[model samples]
Target: MDDRPNPIDRNLLGIYLNDHLAGATLGVDRARTLADAESERDPALADAVRPIAEEIAEDRAELLKIMRRLEVPVRRYKIVAGRLAERAGRLKANGRLVSRSPLSPMLELELLRLGVEGKAAGWRTLRRLADADTRLDPGQLDNLLERAHRQLDTLEQLRLRQVSTTFQESGDRPVHQESHA
Candidate 1:
């Protein structure tokens, strides 16, 4: 039996993994930011976010381990790009005075939710391929999937509450008098 692994496998996996790492990195930052911002508005929500952020960070480390096992080198450029992209996300237009804008946290929560959804799909894909590729474990992927689901739920609930309180009845503008200056 030809034991040579498919060359396509490593290339595809490396690309996907690099992208996955980007989302995980962004998710880690966004989750922590959300938790910190919510501390003033909703202490309980902030408290709930700390553990999720910690877990996601741990999962990112696990991704590095998986990449190492597959002999796939991490594209450091992608990591740098992801960091830049997240910094750009922080610069989004959010009407504000001098203090931190409410839009900041709300937009971040939405991004975090989207990132978790992406992570869930990535885990499911890995789980399906685990049988063919010995580098991955289905059980570990399942655990990640479950965690992603929980994180998604939390973000959705928080996003809705934030939307309700931040937006006006018109739902187009901030409830607070925005400084157009």
Candidate 2:
């Protein structure tokens, strides 16, 4: 048996936890600062920070997995934060558009079978469809539908932001509209 502890194992199981936590916190803090600074100087840079924050969050999760595999208990705070960070990363990956552009007839039929009807009911219906496999409770279904709606709202916000940026960049000139005589 090797009496000497593996340096890599010691580093990963010991110093790595402290360093990972510190690095995650510092990275997020620096990203926030950079975003604030760029908000005034360069909106693009501020937008860029969103992706950077997401990357740091992903890195943090990978580190957590390694810690878990080593039989080390990660702090509860870190675990919770990692979950939230993973969610944020997922939302970023999903992009800005929720795309409510007409469900397929088959999907619509499925929704009707699930007892959901009419517009604005698509999300709830879709949740029902998903719950078929996931076996989510009623409350869970409600929460999932709420999240879907929130995602749609995020898309709307992004669209509005893009429009505002375009207007500002175009010197506030209204787009040319043709009139039919």
TM-score of every prediction relative to native: 0.82, 0.34
Query: Residue 165 deviation, candidate 1, in Å?
Result: 1.4
Best candidate (score: TM-score)? 1
Question: Which ten contiguous residues of candidate 2 have the minimum total lDDT?
Answer: 100-109
Q: lDDT for every model?
A: 0.79, 0.42
lDDT at 110, model 1: 78
What is candidate 2's lDDT per residue for 1-181, written digit by digit as tens? 8665233444443454644444455444444544554454446646855554455455445545544654556565664564465345333322236621112112212322222112125335424444342332456446534643543454345444445444354446334334466
| Model 2 / residue 164 / CA error / Å | 27
What candidate 2 gets wrong by more than 4 Å, as runs, is 1-12, 75-181
Q: lDDT, candidate 1, residue 127?
A: 87
How many backbone clashes does every candidate have?
Answer: 0, 0
User: Model 1 reaches what TM-score against the true structure?
Assistant: 0.82
Residue 180 CA error for candidate 2 (Å)? 38
